[model samples]
Target: MIIALTATTQLGGIAWLIGRPFRQSLLVSLASYAVLSISAIWVAPAFGRTPLSCVPEKGGAHAGIIFCVTNRHYVTPELKSALNDIVDDLNTSFPGIQLGVLDASFPFLNDFPMLPHLSHNDGRKADLAFFYKDSDGRPLPGGTLRSPIGYFAYETGRSACPATRFDLHWDLNWLQRVWSKHELDIDRTSKLIEAATANPRIRKVFLEPHLQKRLDVNHPKVRFQGCYAARHDDHIHLQL
Candidate 1:
């Protein structure tokens, strides 16, 4: 288009200098197309590009650096519908609050544990982390990475990923604690919990009961963190 404009609209006689037709001029400027396309993609976000993605297909782009998805688990059509709706709401309602989905299920089209999860055998389960805020009451850092189960909670703008996981010991896993109070940005976690519960299809939300008490989250949708299996401190288990 640029070439066509430059070769014709700007100077009609200029077409003869390159080659008669606009098509010929376009071919001559093929290299320009590559450069412009690359530049456009790079610059689009700065201008006003809202990035969206689906795991196993388009999962790289993120709304904010706030969260990282640990695994590219497959999702059911129903689960995907719920996920999209929740994300759409969160994106619009809480513009800067980026939700990180750690795991779902596989595309097997049936129920089964996706490893470490006793349940989730079906497509009705999804995992997302609590949104954190800095001490000064700012949105938590976006670069938190998802782990095998829970999420990595780190202080913003630092190389520290202070969050820890279960012990490698065979029996110690069940006795493990999810997170310490100092490691989390508690202010924003409440909002993330409410958002997960906001969805109508959400049947249950699993998190540490003590947290539920600490935040005074009276929502009936929130349930006790789990049994002797995995502690639900680092992440929220949203199930339909």
Candidate 2:
């Protein structure tokens, strides 16, 4: 009887040992699956592979001011510095003006279909927009401003009431006038571009046609960095 009891106990212990590994394996598999599910929900959207959960909504003091779509990884150091310098000059020139940076680089694949070949592809371009305001602290009378750069589809015929047309224009006239008159702002932007070009790392500086016209061809102080690359209509694209 004692021998029989010993054999039964040994068999029971063997079965318990065998089951422990299966239980542990099941727990591990569950944990791995949970982790993968959470990652797919959050991390995948940042790379343009999935739809974004957090769509941008209007926040600031203004209601119609829509937030820009951007990913932090798309901005390079050089581009960021250039943008900051521009903002500083703008703030100094037009104090208390509400200026904001728009699309630096859209994370969505088809976000800006019209500007498919934009410099944002390589993280070297940014779209900027200014807030419209009246003499009072209220929003202007017009509808929200469309994107400064990009193609839009519109109907050619007047009968097509629902149809719209593409209109492309950059409001740089004020900026041109301001830069022309403000010596300090001009010097700042010039120096910024100079530093950008001085680096042996940079290969070219693309300027808009209007900007090229404004720059003196034989200005001894300014360097003729590079010829226009045809693609830069709204913002200058610097190549490094």
Candidate 3:
């Protein structure tokens, strides 16, 4: 039959192809298979299906524990890992500090007019608020919290620097209060700065001179965990 002859020809052609160089053919076949397998592993997710049962939700708290915020549409695995490390470090540094993400969501960044250039839009930045509770064990609203013990002011005003004038768009009173209340003395803040600087991922930490002065001379018991670049004065922005 024609089908039988066709099958014979196909088998014969394959046998000839394989016999030409057995070792090379086997290696080439294996390499092709590996490529296909890897492609399948990485490509399936893009098509809207995932192998894992639990996928991380975007721009929200996970497990009522750690919170996340990103400006980008998707979060890279590297960023997620780095954020996890930071959260772990914070928990170790301050026990029972309830973690939450600030985005275009609830009380923090959501609905608030953000500063133009100072806003955390690159998905690499975040603002963290200290968690506080009342005697009834209920979360105290951020507005109710006392300001940190420090005062913040620009050392030099630059007409060219829009971020230096960030007070025009953002309300940093709450953040200033938090830092003022919680900032540690200079010696302790220095230790925290040292630890953050030692990390390869952290580029820099900028503290307002006035804020630093307050921590150094004015009040005690306040400790700074870390800080970002100068542009982050309007908000506590974290880069990963």
Best by lDDT: 1
| CA shift of 150, model 2, Å | 5.4
The local lDDT score (0 to 100) that residue 160 gets in candidate 1 is 16
The whole-model lDDT of each prediction reads: 0.49, 0.35, 0.33
In angstroms, the error of model 1 at 15 is 56
- Residue-wise C-alpha lDDT for candidate 1, range 1-240, written one tens digit per residue: 435433222222233344434676656444444344334334434422212243222212132222112112434455556666665665554554455666554333244334456666565776775655444656654324333334543222211112345521122333334433334556556766676688887889876666677666788899874344465655678888
Error of 2 at 73 (Å): 9.1
Which stretches of candidate 1 lie above 4 Å from their native place? Answer: 1-72, 134-137, 141-143, 146-183
**TM-score order of candidates, top first:** 1, 3, 2
Give the per-residue Cα lDDT of candidate 2 at 35: 51
- Estimated TM-score for each candidate: 0.54, 0.34, 0.36
Off by over 4 Å in 2: 1-73, 98-103, 106-115, 128-205, 214-231, 238-240
Per-model C-alpha RMSD: 15.7, 19.7, 19.4
Compute the lDDT for candidate 1.
Answer: 0.49
Clashes of each: 6, 2, 12
